[model samples]
Target: MPFLLAAALCSVLVSVLLKLARRLEVDVGQAIAWNYVVAAAASMLVFAPAPSALHAATAAWPALVGLGLLLPTIFLALAGSVRHAGIVRSDVAQRLSLLISLLAAFVLFGEPLSAAKGWGMAAGLAALTGLMWRPSKGAISGGAAGWIYPLLVFLGFGVIDVLFKRVASAGVPLGAALLAMFVLALLVSLVLQGWRLARGTARLGARSLAAGLLLGLLNFGNILCYLRAHQALPGRPALVFSGMSLGVVALGALAGMVVFRERLSRINLAGLALAVLAIVLLARG
Candidate 1:
């Protein structure tokens, strides 16, 4: 339970950090790029992954490569989402990605679609609709891309989940697989950042570096704590998953409202409520 709570806290902290990037004058791209460096190093120190598993005959190279390409790019999308949308809505949209993973389970993995899960899917879709609904008259800095970024975040996370599942099915240990992704993502991020630097678009800064280090720590803590939660309760994966999902939503909302003073429309609030319901139903199913 404690590990679960810590994991959720870490997750929300990640969102909050992204939201604060603009105000803190932190270059998010640079921060994220540096984030992978810190994360990859930490993975090596903590996980000590067996190099042999990667060379095994049944290695999930395709999935690992996919994750390598996607992780940093999706992280950029998430930063855009949080920058454009309030943290509350962004977090809810992220957690609601379970809907996509559920569909993948049914279609790709041949899992049964129970009635409760079906209804949960319906509710999840409606929640997404409600959250993305905006007043037609509003002319803010964000236009169509406001909603588009969050949708990307939603879809991107779901796909990442599927890729992780694929890797797991290939018999790779979780620690090793995670370490592999971090290292691969780090390489990808470095290349992109190097291009940016070459173009004179962005320069490496101490602030971004510091922020990235912190982000890396929190991001890794979230995963490690979540792993601990599951280990502590081996027979209750559903409980651990649900707790982490729900806790992030709840705490993220609080941080958005109380700390950031983000305002939400009635429809958005309803969407948040429905997102909670969808998670509950999906977990039970």
Candidate 2:
């Protein structure tokens, strides 16, 4: 339970830091590249994932490479979402991404669809619609920009989940897959950062460096604690899943509404409730 709580806290804190990045003059791209450096190092130290495992005969190169590409790309989208949309909607939307994976399970992977999951999917779609709505000007500063990034976050994470499932299906260990993905993602980030530096669009800043280091720690903490939570409650997968998801939504709502003072409409609040319901139904299914 402590691990679950820590995981949820770390996840939301990542959003909070991103929200503060622009104000702090932190170059998010540079920070993200550095984050992978720390994350990949932590992966190697903690998981000790082998370098050769990535090229094993059974390795799922497509999925691994896709993750390598998407992790950092979607991370940028996540930063945009946090900046444009309030943390509440962004966090809920992220949790609701499981709907995409659930659909893929039924359609692509031939998993049996249950009534609860069907209802959950329906509610999740509705929740997404409502969450993306900007009924009031106070919802977010930019009208369309508010929803676009959150939508991207939703879709991008959903696809990442599908890719992760593919890697899991390939029988490669999760730790090895993550390490490979992180290393590849680091390389991708560096290439992009290098290009930006060459074009004079970005500069190396101590602030960005500091933020990136902290971001890496929080990001790695989130994954590590969640994994530990699952290990702690191996017999109760639902508990860990629900705890992590709901905990994020709840904590994010508090932070966004109370601490950040972000505003939302009644419809948005209804969407929040639906998101909670969808999560419960999905967990039960």
TM-score of model 2 relative to the true fold? 0.98
Clashing pairs in 1: none
**Alpha carbon lDDT of residue 191, candidate 2?**
92
**CA lDDT of every candidate:** 0.89, 0.92
Clashes of each: 0, 0
Candidate 1's C-alpha lDDT? 0.89
The true-versus-predicted C-alpha distance at residue 34 of model 2, in Å, is: 0.5
lDDT of 2 by residue, 1-285 (tens): 999999999999999999899999999999999999999999989999766776773559998889999999999999999998979988998999999999899999999999998999999999999988886556468778899999999999999999999999888877898888889999999998999999999999999999999999999999999999999999999899989999999999999999899988888989999999999999998
- Winner by lDDT: 2
The regions of model 2 sitting more than 4 angstroms off are 57-59
TM-scores, one per candidate: 0.97, 0.98
Off by over 4 Å in 1: 137-141
